[model samples]
Target: MSREPMRRTIRGGRPYFFADPAIDKILNMVVVLGSEVWTLRERLAAFEAIQVRQGGLAAGEIDAFDFSPEQEAKLAAERKEFIDSLFRILQEQVEEARGRTARAPQKPAEPVAARKRAVPVRGKSSKTAKRRSRR
Candidate 1:
């Protein structure tokens, strides 16, 4: 029997459950890169088609076209930079939507105005009567 690759059954895993935000960040980056790679593949197909049509190159040759050292290095460097940037963004997990946002300590709530004003205790007593709030 053939086994199916592991599949995420529920919207992929939840990133919030982990104590470390890095996991979430990296996971998100992976998803983004996956989409980008698909986009690149589609573009590559079109690019190769154009090259074959106009340059009269065989599909296989165009597919394996050689790049000059400078071009090759540039592309390699660009890919490295993209991956680095993606990870760097992960490192800065504070900006991630699912990451815990540092909220400024909420200002102590102002004392709510009570509808009833405290009246001086009658005969040294401590009970006060409720009064309607003043507009």
Candidate 2:
């Protein structure tokens, strides 16, 4: 029998654990990535142990390993997908904010007369005073 991984389906938005929801989401993503990294590390260690038991690998063999063009392209795609997933929450928030702004009714622009401007005073030594003196 094959087993399928159980997934948690979040309805609406996820509950905020911190004051800022973004912080909470970022922390969640970090923990998830950390768990995934730990799992991969454990698997690699186990695989290396088995390889040693069979036939010992050369020092720095894993580090020196190079991927083919095809493999590199595949890894690149996967990396892009991983990055998109990591920042998806922030992207969604930005999109939502944009949508709200688009739907909002904008205030009408004030007329030229209604807008605030500096009124030239006929004070001594002022531009108005100079014009008057010239006249």
TM-score of 2: 0.45
What TM-score does model 1 achieve against the real structure?
0.36
In order, the Cα lDDT scores of the candidates are: 0.64, 0.73
RMSD of each: 18.5, 19.8
Compose the digit string of candidate 1's lDDT tens values, residues 11-102: 86654745888887788899999999999999989988887899866769955879999999999999999998879856543343222223
Worst 10 residues of 2 by lDDT: 116-125
Clashing pairs in 1: none
- Name model 2 segments beyond 4 Å from true: 1-36, 56-59, 97-135
Native-to-model Cα distance after best TM-score fit, residue 115 in candidate 2, in Å: 23
Model 1 regions more than 4 Å off: 1-15, 54-56, 68-135
Residue 106 in candidate 1 has what lDDT? 48
